[model samples]
Target: MLGAKRETVSRIISQFKKAGIIVHENGNLVVLKMDDLKEKAQ
Candidate 1:
């Protein structure tokens, strides 16, 4: 895991959402796809 705080995780999730890497639904976070994130991270 990332070993981040709740707020930190929330913030990062929000950023990822903005970048279309993941999505929040029904109070849960789901990774829509990892390709974009992986590609951009490299």
Candidate 2:
């Protein structure tokens, strides 16, 4: 649990998915672009 509201988490996940930085596959989250993800973290 991220400790945030479910809606907030879902929104962020959607953003990441749209950005092609992550994906939801078979009920699991997969990071498609690790470098991009790290960049976003900064």
Candidate 3:
């Protein structure tokens, strides 16, 4: 568990979606740009 609130997680996921870093398909999350995602994580 990341220990983050659900709202916090949801917001971050929404940001990622907006940035085209990830997507939700068939109830699964797919990473579109691993390098970009890693950069964002930093």
Best by lDDT: 3
Please report the TM-score between candidate 1 and the true structure. 0.46
lDDT by candidate, in order shown: 0.56, 0.58, 0.58
1 versus 2: better TM-score goes to: 2
Q: Please give the distance, in angstroms, between residue 10's alpha carbon in candidate 1 and its true position after superposition.
A: 0.2
C-alpha positional error of residue 3 in candidate 3 after TM-score superposition, expressed in Å: 2.0
Check candidate 3 and list the clashing pairs: none
* Rank list by lDDT: 3, 2, 1
In the range 1-42, model 1's lDDT, one tens digit per residue, is: 334456765677778779977655623434434334445656
lDDT by residue for model 3 (10-40), tens: 6877887889777576225433344355567
- Output the lDDT of residue 36, model 1: 47
Q: What is the lDDT of residue 14 in candidate 1?
A: 79
| Model 2 clashing residue pairs (backbone) | none
Model 1 segments beyond 4 Å from truth?
Answer: 25-42
User: What TM-score against the true fold does each predicted structure earn?
Assistant: 0.46, 0.50, 0.52
